[model samples]
Target: MAASNSIAENIAGSPNHKMLHGTLQAAGLVERLGGDGEYTVFAPTDAAFVQIPPVTREGWMLPAQKQVLHAILNHHVVPGRIDSAELERLVDAGDGAAILKTLDGRDLWIRRSGASYILTSGSGNKAVITEADLAQKNGVVHIVDAVLIPAT
Candidate 1:
């Protein structure tokens, strides 16, 4: 809500705050992602979490699956602060689609769907950016409708 807040802080106040925060903590990525940076995060809402099977979500939260959870969360983050405008420019530059390199070393495709942006993951699953450009101290947050899962 406030510009002084970090990405993590913003998430803590968001509607999906609980699930997002829990996932970050479980993956041990809270500090890294919460730290200073020009990063972009496609934050999924609690409704999005429903898309994931209960067993899968439960498994990912286990200590033994830390790496898996880390990778999954990292897949939602881009290295630079890519606001909606920048994302639009990149999409136009790439001729209607841009390939964004995520922090997890995966490529997420960005494209325009009408007036909004759509993220197509490595697995061909799509997530719409429902809310764009929530600014934070560390970077920006885009509320997405689906949780992005990278291709295996």
Candidate 2:
């Protein structure tokens, strides 16, 4: 990906975004998150959101849920770009564990298991990085298989 494209643009340009673009835009977070400096967004695809319980996802889409949506999205972002190699090094220096501060003002624990990287939220919810090192202008995105929910 080129540095000119923001994380949202990169995702929107992706084939996967076709289905979720409207939802993201409707939520009013597209513009704020899109076209900014480089950022690594652990974006959840439409399918991933589908995996969420229907009622839960519905509740989150409500106008009152804006804060929650922002929190969830921000949880997926870290201030600076952190690639897998640097993450690995950090984990190694920390004895296979490191803490990543999210944009949501929460701490996410990163751990290395063999060759894989696992992210654990303060609530103990964990998600593994299924795809890493997706370079974007603002930062790098590491695709995760599951969503991480912070403790309420």
Candidate 3:
């Protein structure tokens, strides 16, 4: 599973995250994410990306949109490793919901949805944690079903 690799390395090697890997490269965030620091990335899979409107998706890839893309990517990352177990504890402590501060200086609310969990953005966009807790050398990655759009 190459659990010893950094978050960016693992994402780059993952077949399901090809689009995300490329986007990170375009956003110039690969180096920082791969460096020595604890991070939790709610990575959207290739399939999840397909759900976005083609034109909207393509626009984000433009050179002029690099900073915008970076913000979108940063919205998915947290400062520390908040694995599923820890998320559960936090949710319980918050009386069924917890506000996690994202690396982009925004908040992401996590709530229990039956047996699984879901993250709701400030804009009200919801992304279910499809796959959780893929450990890496510096942190972990969780695959989400949808792109989490942060509030403007």
Q: Rate the local accuracy (lDDT) of all candidates.
A: 0.88, 0.74, 0.91
Residue 130 deviation, candidate 3, in Å?
1.2
Off-target runs (Cα >4 Å) in candidate 2 are 1-4, 17-27
TM per candidate: 0.96, 0.87, 0.97
Model 2: per-residue Cα lDDT over 1-152, one tens digit each: 45567777777787755434554665666775575655556665666666778898777778898788667767777877789898988899999899888876798899988888888877787788888888877778787766677777
Q: How many backbone clashes does candidate 2 have?
A: 5
lDDT of 3 by residue, 27-54 (tens): 9999998998899999999998999899
Question: Candidate 2: worst 10 consecutive residues by lDDT?
Answer: 17-26
Residue pairs clashing in model 3 are: none
Q: Which candidate tops lDDT?
A: 3
Off by over 4 Å in 1: none
- Give lDDT for model 1: 0.88
| Highest TM-score scorer | 3
